[model samples]
Target: MALAIFDLDNTLLGGDSDHLWGEFIVEQRIVDPAVYKERNDAFFNDYLAGRLDIQIYLSFCLQPLAEHSAEQLVAWHAQFMREKIEPIMLPAARELIRKHRDAGDTLMIITATNRFITAPIARAFGIDILLATECEKADGRYTGHSTDIPCFRDGKVTRLDRWMLENSQSLDDSWFYSDSINDLPLLSLVDHPVAVDPDDKLRAHAEANGWQVLSLR
Candidate 1:
């Protein structure tokens, strides 16, 4: 069976989960609303401009996990899922996933967002295999630091190569769907690269490369 890999943010969902999580925490007063939001917005803009420093962004994003108890964080996440994520869930995305499932393809999601925020969303999508940026934990508490290379840009290729080796999977006849130009490294490796609701840069690249481009929204 072929492997069907999907990008979590803007590709499958109607919005960016990592950025939305930042907004959610600000609304919850879990962070300094004004200052935190300003930084969050700047980071998101950097991401869109393809110039984000994933390390610094991860540090800023994961600090809240360090400050709060795991229990509290879980509770907040449940609320965040209901309030922020549910509304943006795309029916078209689900249909596409099901189409691959019916074809007996192995489904996976690879996202730059941390596991804390994306794990449940992957489960909700019925995708068992997920490769996401990992948040380091110590003594059952978050350490506010990432454990490995951030699953972003070329790092996605690095992470996927390791996963494929360990799992005995190959990119032969594999399909990858993404919305951002940041995923170009991984997208180029796949047999079928789909640009779903792509941003301007990715759209331009997809058109120039003759990759299939469509909207999920």
Candidate 2:
């Protein structure tokens, strides 16, 4: 079967999940807003500009996971899904995924966000396979560190290739829909690269390459 990979942030949802998660933490007083809110904004801006330091960003993003128990995290995430994610779930994006599902495509969401944050969100969209940056665990608790590639920029291509090998699949008849220029590596590898509500750099790149540009907003 062919692949249909999706990016989770602004590509599918109306807002950035990682950024919104940070904001949610601040709003819930889970993290000290004074300390983390500014850094979160800065990291998000860096991401948009394609200048994010993945290690630094991941440290800030995953530390909370290490601090909280798995049960607490599940409870928090359930609340997060209700308050932040569901409201932003665009009908157009859902319909797009549905169309691909109806076509019998193998659907997945490959995101730079860590699995802890994006996994349930992917499932909410009925996607089972999520290739996201993995947070390392020790003794059933998070270590606040990634065990493998960050799955950002070029790492996405690397991770995808490895997943393809393990699954006996190929990108020969695949499609990827994303918004950021950071996804260009995997976007180029796919047979059909669709820029969904892409940033300026990605829009220009898509136009130059004759890739399809879609506005999911």
* Candidate 2: clashing residue pairs, number: 0
- For residues 52-163, write the lDDT of model 1, one tens digit per residue: 9999999899999999889999999999999999999899999999999999999999999999999999998999999999999999899999999889999999999999
Q: Which candidate is the best by TM-score?
A: 1
Return the TM-score for candidate 1, rounded to 2 decimals. Answer: 0.99
Model 1 bad stretches (over 4 Å): none
Listed in order, each prediction's TM-score against the native is 0.99, 0.98
- The TM-score of candidate 2 is 0.98
The Cα error of candidate 1 at residue 89, in Å, is 0.9
Candidate 2 — which pairs collide? none
Best of the candidates, lDDT: 1
How many clashes in each candidate? 0, 0
